[model samples]
Target: MTKNETDERRAAMALLAAATARELDSAWTAWPERPAVEDLRKAACGLVMVRGRIGGDGAPFNLGEATVTRAAVRLSTGHIGHAYLLGRAPERARLAAIFDALWQDVSARPRVDTELLAPVRARLAAEAAKAVAEAAATRVEFFTVTRGDNQEAAS
Candidate 1:
């Protein structure tokens, strides 16, 4: 493989990885189940999605009709959190709710955005860079020595 080929692969991987990271970050930031209050409506607090189970190592088994709920929250002081429990645990919901409340507090947004989101993004960038570098490192060049037009060998 030539340097150009390696560079192209690196660019493609970086784009894909960066896109995936951005999407995850967006989902975390914009959870769906937010309350609508008269005075203060906050950014999405938690998200609920239907996930299918694949294996049985105590693993989630998608019954084709069952789903689980997951939530994420950022505390007022910028502590991020996540929860995904079995059978829609109300306690987990409450935990997420509590964090949501804390997150909505006017003081929480800046720190969470700056500290947590920023670092996660930075780490993602670093990982993408490392991946590209590693791929590039493995690139190989192939060449063939052809006979010169003047076939006489130099003494």
Candidate 2:
């Protein structure tokens, strides 16, 4: 896949991670007909070593281990998709993998992008904006004044 495809898939996965159970269920329900999906790798939870850097480009180090659930699904049409969710949400990981496979299809991309991703994107954006506004509301600014000889003499 090209860089664009990789980026698009990454963004789709990110949005899928934020999708609610209701949203995923609704997406599945709304489909006119469901394709046969095979679990190449059933949803399973495991620990993965988290890596971090002193700075973004600094040397990498193992931060710690995090619980991650991952799954892989293959559409009847032969498209394979995989997902790794942050927590042990089997249902979410399974649904996300299925959606990832669906998004790969040219015909199904529109529906997946609209019905699932759009709502999640909107919700996340709203949440981020609210957080920024809340933080701004409580924001403080500090400044230091320089004392001059004249001020000292006056005192």
Candidate 3:
């Protein structure tokens, strides 16, 4: 695959993983059957340091630490999958990793994309749009008005 295609696939997998367990469960019902998965590493919770940069371009600094759950699994056919998720939802992490592995399989990619990833992507986009609209509604605009003295000075 080309670089662009690889990047796009990675992005799609990320979107699939962002789905909540409820969403995944709903989508999974539509799937014909679940692929067999073997847990290489059961889900475990750990701390990761969150980092940020001042003004998005300045020196980076540790913002804080966040709790994350991670898991690793292998498909019956030998594909490996891994996931890292914020908070302590081990089941979600496992499910996400399974989806990730399934997504890598060419035969499974279409089904996973259509039944699982697409809906999640749409929902996330809709939520983001709503947030942007709500923030826009409260937006404040500022302007400057020239006083008589300033106008005279310019003249």
Candidate 4:
């Protein structure tokens, strides 16, 4: 595949992996049955160190650890898929992997995109917007008053 296509596919897979279990379950219920998927690697959970930079460009530091689950599957047609998700939702990881594999199939791509990924994407976007609005509602703006001496006033 071309670079752009590869990037797009990667982005789609990332979205699938990041989806919540409820979102995935809803999309899965709407999807049609397909060929059986063989587990290339069963879902497993582990801890990974979360890292951060001082100012996003400074030295990196360990923020903490986070639980992560990962799974791999191969469709009957030989397309392979994998997913890594936060927390211990094994089933969610597996389902995400399956969708990733389905997305690679040309015949299934359109259906998977429209039926599965699109709705989840929309829901996620709406939730994010709602969260942003809620946060904005609670926002407190601060202002500083200058002294007559052209110096900043201590508040």
Candidate closer to the true structure by lDDT (higher is better), 3 or 4: 4
Off by over 4 Å in 3: 142-155
For model 2, the superposed segments whose C-alpha errors exceed 4 Å read: 55-57, 143-155
> Model 2, range 117-155, lDDT digits (tens) per residue?
998999899999999999999988887565675676543
Model 1 deviation from the true structure expressed as Cα RMSD, one decimal place: 15.2
Instruction: Work out the TM-score per prediction.
Output: 0.33, 0.87, 0.83, 0.83
| TM-score: model 1 vs. ground truth | 0.33
What's the best-to-worst order under lDDT?
2, 4, 3, 1
For residue 95, give model 1's deviation from the true position in Å.
8.6
Error of 1 at 105 (Å): 5.5
In terms of lDDT, model 4 sits at 0.88
Which window of 10 residues has the lowest lDDT sum in candidate 4? 146-155
Estimate the TM-score for candidate 4. Answer: 0.83
Report RMSD (Å) for each prediction in the order shown. Answer: 15.2, 3.1, 3.1, 4.2
With candidate 4 superimposed using the best TM-score fit, by how many Å does residue 150's alpha carbon deviate from the native? Answer: 20
lDDT of 4 by residue, 46-75 (tens): 999999999998999999999999999999
lDDT of 1 at 4: 80
| TM-score-better candidate, 1 vs 3 | 3
Candidate 3 on 1-155: residue-level lDDT in tens? 79987896788767855889897667666656666789999999999999999999999999999998999999887888788878898888888888888777889888888888888889999999999999999999987666767787553
Local error of candidate 2 at residue 7 (angstroms):
0.9
Cα lDDT of candidate 3 equals: 0.83
Q: What's the residue-level lDDT of 75 in candidate 3?
A: 83
Q: Which stretch of 10 consecutive residues in model 3 shows the poorest summed lDDT?
A: 26-35
